[model samples]
Target: MQGGVMRRRLRRRFGLGCLLVGIALVVAQSAAAEPRRLEVELSQLFDRLDSGFSNWQGQRLEFQSARPGDPTWYGAATHDRRYGVEDEGVSLGAAVPLGADWVLQPEAGHTFDADFLPRWYADLRLQRRLSHGLVGALSLRRTEYQASRVDRLALGMERYWGPWRAGYTLNVSDVSTAGTPVGHALALDHYYGERSVIGLRASLGREEEGLPGGEAITSEVTAVALRGRHWWHPEWALSWELGTLSQGDLYDRHGVQLGIRHAF
Candidate 1:
């Protein structure tokens, strides 16, 4: 009996020890032209496997419907918990071709009733295809709450070499009540078999958190994640991710998310 208990403990730790999470399942999470991507995901925290896989304090249910195009407009709704508090929000976004090599993306989200989650958030990004199978992007985001606001700027570059892609991003951020912080992230991914992919990411940075009663804290954070998806059928895919995060003397997080996706 004792040994069985020990095994269970090890099972949980193994996944946590590997690394935390990501905007994982690459091809399975994003829709392709004329095909739609639908996913259901679960993690210990509100971890959306988006381009920015930032984990918040609550669990969430999210759904997205992408419009028809190479990379077009999409809408999403999220009912998530933040710092153990619950909140809900809906978002709409679009990606428009600026020219032959450039694209512009704009998005906005709002919560009917604000809580730990922001009352509203918005962002705009510009991406350009560069020489030598490379892409570059710049983005700015603003998240507003009842009493404080957070702003962020990011610059990124990515390179494609055959079936592999490598990317790096730099982020600078400030909060009305917290200190400024900078972060760095690196990612590598391999694609094959029409719509299957495997990816790994690592990030390190300083983070700011607004506490209750207008207080706040700043800390250093480190995270690593591995995510992948395999399509067993033309219309179905299996997705999974493992991740871990270390925060300066605050807490250590290790978790996983398993999802099923459908292409329609």
Candidate 2:
């Protein structure tokens, strides 16, 4: 009887030890299997850029719309007319962790029009975290217009402060006829919540004349946009935006856009 009791006790002790070892192994494996968190977003914008032409100085104003074969000018005698121009663009973007305190994002976008003009853009940015809820980013972007075969490069710095973000971009454009023209842009964006955002962006740029003998023309653009997203499931979402664009002295453009996204 004594020998049997001793054997039973030894068996119980060995069983408990095995269970503990199993639990420890599981905990270690789970820690090793955990994945780092990363965030990515893809967005599209359907908008219009209206160029309101007004008589300023002695220049004969010709207002051209994006629509194909539209009259270049309603009449030189008329000073007030509306030009309706629109563009549809889609962007694919991804953000990933590079290391501690650093992140990198790369994005590409393409725009198509009914008039056989297409635009393509590529951007790469690197961000570093700073103290006091601040972050800084350095970005490089390239844009190409397929119809005209013109290309532009932009270098910029972005700053984040609390819920507000701002950036300045410098652009150098190469035209087939005019050597190169430099432009500058400044933009501001504000976030109201985790999923709601508003942005006010403006850019002042110059474009060389399409014709051989035309001189460089200055262009200015201002835009205000509001965007929001709602998650229906863990991997699915709906997003929407409303925005307005003003180009030079031509016209004001208003647009609304919606999209649905799913993640695998």
Candidate 3:
């Protein structure tokens, strides 16, 4: 009986994740055609996954504001319910531009549950556009977990071909929990005029989870995601994202995110 329930949850999560990702990508691509100075986005996420202990269902609400060449801010509230426990959390983050091509993003948040811990993260990125329709970025990130801290470095490159673009990113991380891990991601997107876009992305990485007694479990993480964006008007757009996360055969999750945005 328990196995049946788990399977059902997994299927639902996968479907929802796909739907959400698809819509988000569509809207984002569409909105990029006529860029706005001030943008507001609201999103909802439905997720199901295992986190070492039990399977949980998460409902998250998020709000974001972005200004091109300036700063972007986001906040989110999440509720997770499982068989044995319920958890809630609120998170906020900001990405601020340091120059024409540098951005610093810092995020901190606290979760309410048995753990009741605060998490902190920060990332610094430098990006530049080349003369030949190419762009590149380098970034470093630090994340503080309850029992461990991790640092990651990434390099990314992108090429633009008319209305289609492709990007690749390579990442490496060092940590006590996950040991040394490496990953990479690829993305491709095509624009249909200035009103719509479709994109696909995939990533494979290694991550560590902290366990009791100062121990950690290392796992391989993989995901494939799709998203799309469409604009109904110059001022309004819709987007969706769908993705599946897998950690070998032991753990799997699917999520869907839906978003709507308006520009001032």
**TM-score for each prediction?**
0.74, 0.49, 0.68
Q: For every model in order, what is the number of clashing pairs?
A: 7, 7, 25
lDDT of 3 at 204: 85
- Which candidate number has the best lDDT? 1
lDDT of 2 by residue, 1-264 (tens): 000000000100010000111111111122333332222233333334334332111111111111111111111111111123333444454444454455565656555541222365576656665554445556675555543444566665556556565667677777654567776666565655332344544555664322111222334545555544455665565655565655456455565545454433
- Output the lDDT of residue 42, model 1: 32
For residues 1-264, what per-residue lDDT tens digits would candidate 3 score against the true structure? 000000001112221111111122212222333342444555556656766645545555555554344455666666655444555666676555555444454555555442322254566555555546666667787755567777889898777666676878898888856688888878787767444667787878775543333233557878887876676896787867788888665677777767676667
Off by over 4 Å in 2: 1-96, 104-122, 130-132, 147-151, 161-166, 177-218, 232-236, 249-251, 262-264
TM-score quality measure for candidate 1: 0.74
The candidates, ranked best first by TM-score, are 1, 3, 2
Give candidate 1 regions above 4 Å deviation: 1-71, 210-217
lDDT of all predictions? 0.57, 0.39, 0.55
Return the lDDT, model 2, position 43.
34
Error of 1 at 123 (Å): 0.8
TM-score of 2: 0.49
